[model samples]
Target chain A: MTHPKTRAPRVARIAGLVLVLLTAVSGCSSPQKWDLTNITGIMPQLKFTLTDQDGKTLQASDLRGKIPVLYFGYTNCPDICPTTLATLAQALRKLGAEANAVRILFVSVDPARDTTAVLKSYVQAFGPQFIGLRGDQKELRYLTKRYRVTYGLGKADAHGNYEVSHSSAVFVFDRKGDVRLLGRGTDPAKSYTHDLKQLINDN
Target chain B: MQRIHWQKHVSISGTHGRGSMMLALLLSCAVANAAPVPSVVITQARVRLLPGNLPLAGYFTLTNDGSAPVTLTGAISGSFKQIMMHRSFESDGMSKMAPVAKLTIQPRKSVHFRPGSYHLMLMGRQQSLSVGDTVPIQLQFKNSGALTVEFKVVPVGAQ
Candidate 1:
């Protein structure tokens, strides 16, 4: 609405100032997180309280403000459970000092066999840093449901041998208590590590 | 069959629409001398193959029918760069897997492998693997000499 000459110069001056400000702020801008954008879809919501291996009561909230890799299985479990945990132990050892910041949680789906004492020995065999947790059947069901993890109880035979069929997905929780991503299987692969590396870098 | 001693069932939840139950994992611990043992058949044998890593892993069970000790040492798998026997151990509460001289299979005894415990390391993967793929492996024992074993490709979380 104003005169052409006056309007043109005013607009130019405003644009020039905006460019200068952007240049000044760009240098101080923070690096964007790759994990946040890549794995934005599968956020996990899990919270439960159970007895720890040390016989102390604990809750999911206590694990807040740190990255945690959690799995659900039994101690007397013949194969995959132990195999996966061992891989985690190997992975953690490879992580060295950085591993200190990460907490690996072993949630016992078999509450009947996994008493606090049983969990203690089982987790201790995997890694000193591992935390084994056991709860009543109702509590375990609630917690597993929150994570969308599936598991089954097998029927007994005359000889009394039984097996447990369970989901082998590994859930990763960020420091903010958001379930960021899932690494499929009992043990992760290089791709899993790559994804994990991305999540760690985000922190 | 009479020589095989199966352990009792343990209860646990099931996954994959396999309803909750008290499942049974049959194990044979007895080694018989008077009776001729039935040869062990390890079905659904497979390894979790990791690309670019040496010494991948293979897990299976020992079913004895001949009633004698067998030393599993020599093995050949086209999928791996190398094949070897290794036992994974948990020490100081940390998991450690290392190469071993041999794995002894007692007469009429069966050994099982799962994650974080005893398993066969594939050493290295020669090709890429997918969820539904399968790789063939050959296992050789000190006494059995050669065994053609095929390992099914399973999810990392599969038992």
Candidate 2:
């Protein structure tokens, strides 16, 4: 029974309220600020104590103050391991002296086959600065579970011929030892370099 | 075909003139066309140099030029104690290597065995191998017979 002019004002008021509500909802669901997928809080604890390429027992805490790029792979991995390590080497080469600020950790999931000496030579072949880490199956399992890494061994024939499947993503940790970014094995070296530079600047 | 064509032209030139030359040219063309082409070709054979006792990775490209498909059953290399075909795959962030029993290539197709995909795992080096060294590997195929190809040893970081 209201006048048309009065009803128009009332409808406008309701529309204005609806518009404000929509803006609030949209703002609450805003996209992340970083280019890479944000996995900041996914893994809260990145602690581990494993043996390095030098056969020395090292703790993750020992690598503080330097950004660590972690990868889970084995030496016998003819494809992904070499490819990923090569990509990382390329990125480090592009960074030049800045590469020293970052540490590359190649965690061998195949502890049975990849010995410290084997890992040392394998990782050092890519870059002398690269550190190879390996541990027992239980220790590796704990670390893999903490980082959500999955790895399994293929069935071996009579000739001791088998393959190990593992995760290929490179987990980048900041100087503070917090997981920051994830780099894929297939990503170009430039992307890794870019991310590392940004992380260096941020840290 | 070229040898036969040359002999035919020489005899024809002694007997006849332009007409005989044209006939000889046509016959040579037909013979050349009928010649069998190479059914399979291997290219880009290279091996990665990994230090210590780690297995080396060999990569190559196999091209089939025949009308029928070809299956690569296995490979043998005297330089390594064992050679096996393997494929690398990544799914849901997990990277895995699986044994490739046999790979079949379609007619007129090529299968690339590159890094992070398919490769030959050469294990237990028989002798010390270094960069610039050439290792002979024999590829066994189902239809195209065995092909012995030389895989040049490349640096570990080389793609």
Candidate 3:
């Protein structure tokens, strides 16, 4: 027969296990505060048509139900654009299975060079799920103008090498195509994932 | 090539037997400091072609080490009909791609070749390239001349 005093430790162990299990189900550890949800002031309504990597036409409205993470840049950008997109890739990986719930779109303002094939291979290099889109400059104008994203071609320097400067902001759209958050420069993967998760939870 | 003068302070006329060894030591030290290789060495060069209407893009990095200023005044490769240095920029809701004739680097500075920015445009590919693969790129430098660097292929969502 076990002594009643010995039974006390067993009861305590059970209680601790139950507390941890309950806490996990109750979502206590993941104190997600989505920092970028206040996005009304940044981006506006955006809708346009563009060619995918396979040269097939795809529309923004066609991506209605899923969350969209969009940014504008050209294929020739040397620094900020690439790094920013690369940083997003890190954040996506950190999202793990939740990454499937999101879509990443790289819309090119330099429509002349960022053809369907250019975007296809470019985005394909990043991940199987990544998508690149480009259209005529006129179409780009319509789309970017709505988003309030700033972009322009710089003047030629002494070497005749013209530069293209564009906005570096990454816009997050909720499942309903409404702007939800805006991410700025150079944040760690954990911060991005936390923000993304919080955004998902809120939606 | 300038060979190092390794003669020790010992007088050649009345020096001990160790004079020759001492000269060798001095020469080695001097040679070590001259033209030290950059910390970011571009080896096994590979440049990827850009698809679409735009030219191809190449990925590479500059390592810095010694004190010499290294400048890459564009590059030329044989993988396509033409290979030139290009940079992308955006402004006023417009983005543009143009050729870059030169890229200069000070001592210990690093330059990265990434998407949506400075990249090599491989035009009119002679053959198709596959993902998860790399191609040889002969990097022509204004200072170090030409050195080959290999680029690791990754997906668009690659980190």
**Candidate 2 segments whose C-alpha is farther than 4 A from its true place:** A1-36, B1-38
What clash count does candidate 3 reach?
49
Superposed by TM-score, candidate 3 places the C-alpha of residue B37 at a distance from the truth, in angstroms, of 11
Candidate ranking under DockQ, highest first, comes to 2, 3, 1
Best by DockQ: 2
C-alpha lDDT (0 to 100) for residue A75 of candidate 1: 63
lDDT of each: 0.63, 0.82, 0.66
Task: Score every model by TM-score.
Answer: 0.50, 0.78, 0.59
Ranking by lDDT: 2, 3, 1
Which DockQ-derived CAPRI band holds candidate 3? incorrect
Better model by TM-score: candidate 1 vs candidate 3: 3
Question: How would you encode candidate 3's per-residue C-alpha lDDT over B7-63 as one tens digit per residue?
Answer: 224233445568767876676676555433323465323344333433445766665
lDDT of 1 by residue, B48-90 (tens): 5332232345677766545677776756778766665656554
- The better candidate by lDDT, 2 or 3, is 2
